[model samples]
Target: MNQPDHEFPDESRTIRPHAGESIEDTRNWPGLALVAVGLVLLALTLTAAGYGFAGWAVIAGALCGVCLLGGIGIVVAEHRRVKAR
Candidate 1:
């Protein structure tokens, strides 16, 4: 018994990387922005709670510090991801 001849295309193509390859930076910016905004709102709330403008200033200061920390974290994480790639 003779088997029927079947033709198949060659499949040995080499995949090449693009010239503009860059690492993806996925450091939740919106989330960080939300946290920063929340901090401002919280400070406003505190001020309205009769703690006076001074209390709001304090809250604002704290929020600023938190935002700084969060930004640093994001930068570090992005750096690590880029280095890993």
Candidate 2:
């Protein structure tokens, strides 16, 4: 009746994926995309500001803020979703 330790898995330490949910479903693609856009806009804003394009810098800076906020929101929402589940 003696079995080796390797014969059984330790359920307590194991993580199981939910049914009907693929690994890809857990990724926040949109959130990551928004963050990327925000970073790009930030670079543009700095460049414009350095060249004395006040209007362009202001516009890009505003857009960068919006994109960063939106991305953070999406990421938080996704985190809550997974936690709730």
Give the TM-scores of the predictions, in the order they appear.
0.41, 0.70
**Clashes by residue pair, model 2:** none
lDDT of each: 0.56, 0.80
Residue 35, model 2: Cα distance from true site in angstroms: 0.4
What's the alpha carbon RMSD for model 2? 6.1
Candidate 1 per-residue C-alpha lDDT over 19-70 given as tens digits, one digit per residue, 9 for 90 to 100: 3322233464644565667677666766655556676667666776677677
**Per-residue lDDT of candidate 2, residues 13-47 (tens digit):** 55553443322554677887899999999999999
Q: Flag regions of model 2 displaced more than 4 Å.
A: 1-27
TM-score of 1: 0.41
